[model samples]
Target: MTPHELYADLTRSGLNLIGQALSIFDADLRLAVANRQYQAMFDLPAELTHPGTRFEDTIRFLVMRGEYGPQDDPEAAVAFRVEQARTFQPHYFERERANGCCIAVEGAPLAQGGWITVYTDITDIKRQESLLRARSEELSGQVLDHAERLAAANRELAATNAALQEAQRILTRTEARTRQVTEMVPAHIAHVDGEYRYTFSNRRLPSIFPGAAGNVIGMTVEQALGAPTFDAIRPWLECALSGEAQVFEITHPTSGRRIRIALTPDSASHGVYILSTDVSAEVQAREALSHASKRSLAAQLTSGMAHDFGNLLTIILGLQGRLAALDLPGHAAQDVQATLAAARRGATLLDRLARISGPREMALQPVDLARLLRDVATLARPSLAEGTVLDLAIDLPDGQVLLDAGALQDSLLNLILNANAAIAGPGVIALEARFSGEWIELTVTDTGPGFTPEALARAAEPFFTTKKGQGSGLGLSMVYDQTKLVGGTMRLDNTPRGGRVRLRLPLRPIARQMILLVEDDDSVRMQVRGQLTDLGHAVLEAGSLAEACAMTDLPGLTMMLSDIQLGDGLGVDLDASLPMVLMTSLPPGDPLRARAQGPVLTKPFTQARLAAALAEAGKRT
Candidate 1:
């Protein structure tokens, strides 16, 4: 037999063994189940005792047999009982039937719209009362009255028992369901007493805090969460106990996860409720946005000043150049050369500042990391001091990753120069690249004195440099900014020999594909066409949207790169289904420029910018 069938059979057998007669009816006023005792007690026929029998029919049969006492009209009595059963309530009473048997009947409602009635025989008790009244003439009327009241009390007790059973059943189900819900939740839900002892938990503490034990109930806070974590949140727990609700975040030392916790005081319960959720991703995003916002504000503040500074430097360099061109004395010539060199350095610093404070966005495109790293190594060699030895350790899979090759090269070169400068003389710099989980980790380690504690902390900040007047300090800041703009991260720390700077970039791999190029201007179109060709893409050119639309149906068409302002019409109006990147020279605030659909690329963009736009378009499509 099936498990359900066996369980039903067992339940029925067990019910039949009970001394009390029991029957259950469905909401439809149809008999659902009855124990054998129920049938025997009522003397019901096979038809009336069987499942699916109408409850009204059983009542009618019983009424006819005077089960509920004699009635003048039995049909009317059956109708009344059926209607009362339809609106069933908790009821208990005793009645002497025509067969001269006294029984107590108790009924309780079910959750899914039904009722169960239990019948307990009380005939012997009733007979004892009659005997007591007839034989005990010496007994007072008060004693006889008390004896009669005993049956009612017994009925009340049976009703109370049934109510308690129903209540207990509901409570058990509710608790089970509540725990199930809390267990399924992503956050940890727990309760702790004022003494900092865990009273209850959903066994999710270990999941949220990697080192915590799952069964932490009855354990002290210290035993559950180790000293480091407990110390961090103990103050908040104290605040919660003082009838305050607080929310905070902490970094898990073991797992390095950012956890957001909320604690609320339970005044009546004399404990605190805790909720904790892993919010590492959220915290990272928030930090990135905050950094970006600060950069934007700094950019706005410095743009005008940098402009004037550039103008002043240019004038000085020009005047100094004019003076140096003419024949002069040795000391005068040396002075002019020094002034020109200082102006050039100032100009370089200004350029670095603009880079850090500018509205720079990464142009993520499919880039061959091996080739990029090799080129950066070669480009950085010229900048390193003569005694400095630069070494490259490139270890990466053979694939083009979605990245901004130009920005990446700049950041790496900046690090190489910084490392070269850190080592006063005759030191080696090593660069390594490899994939670490979801991130492409690029590390630059230099054999130098390493960063001072203050430099290590404030290195990413703008204009915080150890090179004094020789360094702009904006180099690392620019690298940090670019890393964050692409949703990546940069870390600076000291190694035993020297400092190590690592950039963690998400590994987004993309394959190079054919691109359909659309632009009206012959020179601009051809220039971009060459750029795309250099990026390992075969480009098909069209001067107008009409031509581009026709070429879109060309077999093997992968994507479209077009100017927002086309010769025939706007490129955004093209009926092409391919992923598109629109190029525009219009000002940023122009409504017409902003209306181009898909990822927009501003005109006067580099090859790297175009590729990044394509990568973004590829992502959306």
Candidate 2:
């Protein structure tokens, strides 16, 4: 027999072992389960005792047999009983059957519809009562009668108590199930009363907002969420309490995460329901998309104008070159040279403008930040005045983080050059790098005259330079653009010591290790090997899964990057100790692709995308 059938048989046998009769019916009024005692007590036929027998049919049979002591109309009596069963409620009663046997009936409604009924025979107790009334000379007639009535009442109360206990059990299970569902959700689900005190919570506050109290059942909103977060949403809370629903977003001051909160008014009480979710990733993605759209529009508007302007600059340069080649008078030659210089400066300005409005993508890769910063200082020192000193202070955990090294290098160089110009002589230029939670912060400070109010407000705006005719003013603007494209932030401020420019970028650290590359195609394998080499990782190539598996025991092997479909076997069947990333050309819905145990990359991908996939694999490991 199947396990399910065996379990059912065991359950039936146990139910039949009970002395009392028990039966269950479904919402459709069909018999679901009945103990052997139930069938024997009613003398029911085989068909009537089976599952799916209608309760109405059973009632009609019993009524026709005079089980209720000869009802005037059997059909009418059956109809009445069936209707009462349809609206069944918890009940207890005692009745004497036509056979003169007494039984106590207890029925309780089920949570998922239908009801359970238990019948206990009380014939022996009834006989004891009759004997006491007929033969006991020590007891008065009135006292004996009162005693019999009290015994029947006590039995009814006992049956009622059993039904009440069953109802409590069902309620407890329901409450536990509801709590489980709410806790499993990825957000905070809570309710607050009119006093702004929390009444119920799923204990998920800490998961959504780091450092939040796990349980806030009796705490006020301000106390639970902190003063700053509470103040930010206080107006919305008031509106919700006044029967108006609200949905809004805010940045948590402590964790720097974006939170989306929805408050719904409870119509039946002076309270509000709350749902809070962490939407930091969503907000970052949306901002990145918005910046990309703006860049596309700028490129379209400037591409044509830039083309025409470039042609004009070329003509001017060519004519000026021809003039300089001629044997002209000395004074006239000097004037010509001056004119050429101005025209050349205009060409340079056009180049900077093109860079500002051009389409570019962040090529993120693992970079040694300390090494990058040292290189920046080495390059900037030669440009600084003789008295100027470049100082570097880096306080960060030991690791390489994902960054666009070239872009960051250019931005830092520009800031250092700008700071050098700001200082007259003998000033300290300090570069500091540190960690702030999931972000890497870099700050450049100079001991020069701090920025004026206007410069502080517009330093990052295009063509808003402090240098009158010497600066192109696109340096800070380009730096700001690059930072925003990668969901980073740039801030300009004036400190007591000097002017400061701070940049904060997401810190995604990835470890460099030897990797196994598995692919059936030689050309693809070679191409991927070159990409890995460029990212500073040693790669070992294999033509199939069997070859890859043979090298799994190699020393210093840290991870694997493999194609899903291999000649001998699938890459997912590899050992799970080493982190893995899979690449495939299979359609998204393909079963093999869906079976990928780690991060999956599409077949045609760039070095940046591969770096990202490897980083994700590292996180999973």
**CA lDDT scores, all candidates in order:** 0.85, 0.89
- Give the Å error, residue 228, model 1: 14
Residue 558 accuracy (lDDT) in model 2: 93
Q: Give the TM-score of candidate 2.
A: 0.82
Q: Which residue ranges in model 2 land beyond 4 Å of their true spot?
A: 69-74, 135-146, 191-199, 213-245, 264-272, 319-359, 374-393, 412-432, 443-481, 484-503, 520-527, 587-589
Query: Model 1: per-residue lDDT, tens digit, 148-225?
Result: 886578668869887888979988998999999999999999999989888889889988898788899899888888
lDDT of 2 by residue, 451-516 (tens): 999987777666778898889878887888888766687777888999999888877787787999
Model 1 lowest lDDT segment of ten? 356-365
Error of 1 at 42 (Å): 18
Off by over 4 Å in 1: 1-276, 289-297, 512-621
